[model samples]
Target: MKKTMLIIVLSVFALGCKPKQTVANTKLDNKTERLMKGDWLVSSVKYVGSDVFKVTSFNIADAKCFEESMWTLVSNNNTGEVVLNKANCATFESKITWYVNKDGNFVMKFLSEGIKAKHTTSGYVLKVANQTETSFQLIDKAAVGSNTAEIVFQFDKIGN
Candidate 1:
């Protein structure tokens, strides 16, 4: 009886630990990816919430610094680069891999020099909103004392 009970417990535990599977919305992903491939500029960064709330975007610099940053998205390989060259802020550039997930989440992983994106265990996810041929926004949420706030990155296409 004891051996049977132990076996049953282990079986249940194994089943419960199985990973969940999610279906990819390939149609949406492909469409968004195609639309996003090109040069873009971070035209503005806005915070929507209490005026006292402060947030750092992507753990890089203040949200304001992201304004005027240039982004190049190459859809063929899902690779890109971001160039932050705003005045009064440290200049920065990074290679990034990005994709649009099934749920319309924009997933991105920044690759440092000599580091492969697959080896990195973490990345950022933001909801894609108001996407168009000329403009789009990436909205990230932050916890603000039990309330949630939004950090919006507005991107405008730079050129053909």
Candidate 2:
């Protein structure tokens, strides 16, 4: 009878200790950090056409030169490295860092320009259009030669 009573009391205590809400509350910043932790691949690049309204998309697979390119994002310190896996392109890595700014836009900073010259000194400040466990979409408005265009970058998580 003593053992039974003790077990019943412990069970009641444990049950009461559990959080009232089944799902723990997660802050938006923390949630974004969690989702951003991974090795991502450039799935596609889309650009606004001459019409300035029409959009044209190009898949990485469609470009035979780029086969296994990947962007490894270090979640802890908002740092990362870009590897452009192509025979013609220089294999040397370029340092990269990224984070969500106060405005909620996703900003990427390149410490050094890679051999491929992915971005300019200004870097890229892109808005996160969508994000999920496996994929994310970033959009930016930038000058394309003589005209301003909308650039959409699509990335898919390849690894943790």
Candidate 3:
């Protein structure tokens, strides 16, 4: 009876102590990590309560002048970073910076210095959804006011 009770307690303790693991940690590789480091293509975009724009081709550059940085930005028209999407005509100079949060997810800042607004700050978590030699998708856990949404960007490696 004592042995049976001990076994039950052990099982309960073992279940409680189980470690959490993620699938991305297993499959992620060095090459994939490097591809993520550089600039790529911004293929699609959607704004909250705003119009939808499907980007056929736009450059995403790693703004290394600062660290913990990523940008899903379009060229500023006045700033002369112009990749037009028809004549609808709106370009963003968005910057996304990353740091590990207390929740163990990436904490990001989405900001822009652009023709529309100055010093705009947005927050998100960019999780690696999928990746390959030429392209990858990042799932942005974006938050605005009391609402939250996901944003994705598919990028192709430059000169690779």
Q: Candidate 3 on 4-87: residue-level lDDT in tens?
A: 999999999999999986642222233434444545655544333533422222133221111222233222211112132323
Comparing 1 and 3 on lDDT, the stronger one: 1
Q: Judged by TM-score relative to the true structure, which candidate is superior, 2 or 3? A: 2
Off by over 4 Å in 1: 1-28
Better of 2 and 3 by lDDT: 2
What's the TM for model 3?
Answer: 0.38
Off by over 4 Å in 3: 1-33, 45-89, 99-106, 112-122, 141-151
TM per candidate: 0.84, 0.58, 0.38
**What tens-digit string does per-residue lDDT give for candidate 1 at 1-160?**
9999999999999999999999544444878888999999999888885557777888888888999999999988999999999999988899999998768888898899999998987888899999999999999998777888998999999978
Task: Please report how far candidate 1 places residue 10 from its true position, in Å.
Answer: 5.2
lDDT string for model 2 (59-157, tens) is 122232333467787777877887666667445456777777545577666675443334434555667768898988777675556877777667898
**In terms of lDDT, which candidate is strongest?**
1
Candidate 1: lDDT over CA atoms?
Answer: 0.89
lDDT agreement with native, every candidate? 0.89, 0.65, 0.43
- lDDT value for model 3: 0.43
Top TM-score hit: 1
